[model samples]
Target: MKSFAFVLSILAVMGLAFWAYGENYKTQRALSEVESLQGQIGQLRETRAVLRAEWAYLNRPDRLADLVGMNFASLGLVPLAAVQFGRVEQISYPRPDALPSELQLGPITGAVTVSAPANAPVPAEDMLIP
Candidate 1:
């Protein structure tokens, strides 16, 4: 009976050790897979950035203008400044109303400084600061 119990105890210990080893191997493999996926993700992100830069370069205004200028001679459309481009100030404001409109009011605000009432609670200096 003693010999049988000792053998069974040794088998149980061996089984526990094998189970722990398998678990460690699984963890290491998962870590390696995670690292590999991170590298792939980084490379793909870099590729996407490069593609975006190229797309911007292709759609640049100067390049499009050059292409249009090369092609417009065949179209025979006479482009003028008023048609092709206009300044914001020229478009936004008319000649007659160049100056801002005169604000009509009850003359509430006066340009010249006036003295406050002698009995005023706050002095003019204190009121100005506040």
Candidate 2:
């Protein structure tokens, strides 16, 4: 009986050893994958920095002015003038009376109720204009 118990314990130990071996490989695979992802992240950060530098170089004001001057005749491009701009009051805003009945908000509840069909297009009269 004692010999049988010793053999059983040895088998249990072997089984546990096999499980630990598999777990060790799994941990190693996970660590390798993490390293690969870190490498990709480093590459992307480097690429982004290079792109930002290139963007800054391309957007230099002097370079843009030179380009504009070179293409002025063909592009018909002209410099902006203060007189070309319009005053805020020059904008023609929609009147409140122009809104449809369905778009009007309730006086007491202040909730909007649309009488139109569910799939019907809603008017933009109630929307705030920038």
Candidate 3:
């Protein structure tokens, strides 16, 4: 009976060792994948930095002015002037009396009608109390 108990303990130890070995391999594989992903992220960041530098070089104000000068006869491009701008008072905004009764600031009383296209899907009605 003592020999049988000893053999059973040995089997349990062997099983635990096998499980530990598998877990170690799984951990190494996960670490390798993380390293690969880090390398890819570094490459993408370098590419983005290069692209931004190129964009800045291409959009220089002096280069744009030169191109505009060369193309002015065909493009009819002209510089902006202050006289072209309009004053705030020149804008025609809607009057308070012209608005619908429901749109006016008041206590909530009934359902509000929202205009939508005929083919548009209708949403479920929700009541809003002020």
Candidate 4:
């Protein structure tokens, strides 16, 4: 009976240790996966930054104009020379007096009448505002 009890105790302890070791292995694996994912995220961010810079370079005004000229030559959007551009002061504008001044009034209402008392002191609030 003593030998059997001792054997059972040893087996229980070993079983507990094995279970703890499995849990520790799983935890370590999860931490490693998290580190790998962090590395991948950083790489993706760097790639996105490089792509944004390349996109800006591709969208430059001169490159866009060249692409349009190649793709849409029939649009007739010719580039102007310096001599073709006109000064703003050389543009003509219609004078305001050229507009007709026709009177068109709506129905008028009677004005309200109020008489002030003689020798009344000016209100203190009105003096303060002015």
User: Per-residue lDDT tens digits of candidate 4, residues 14-47?
Assistant: 9999999999999999999999999999999999
The TM-scores, one per candidate, come to 0.51, 0.64, 0.61, 0.47
In terms of lDDT, model 4 sits at 0.78
By how many angstroms RMSD does model 4 differ from the true structure?
Answer: 13.8
- lDDT per residue (tens digit) for residues 33-62 in model 2: 999999999999999999999999999988
What TM-score would you give candidate 4 relative to the actual structure? 0.47
lDDT of 1: 0.75
Question: lDDT per residue, candidate 3, 53-110, as tens digits?
Answer: 9999999988888888999999987667798889999999888778888865555566
Ranking by lDDT: 3, 2, 4, 1
Model 2 residue 95 lDDT score: 71
* Residue 96 shift from truth in candidate 2, angstroms: 13
TM-score winner, 3 or 4: 3
Most accurate candidate by TM-score = 2
Question: Alpha-carbon error at 122 in model 2, in Å?
Answer: 9.6
- Candidate 3 lowest-lDDT run of ten: 121-130
Model 1 poorest ten-residue lDDT run: 103-112
TM-score, candidate number 3: 0.61
CA lDDT, every prediction? Answer: 0.75, 0.84, 0.85, 0.78
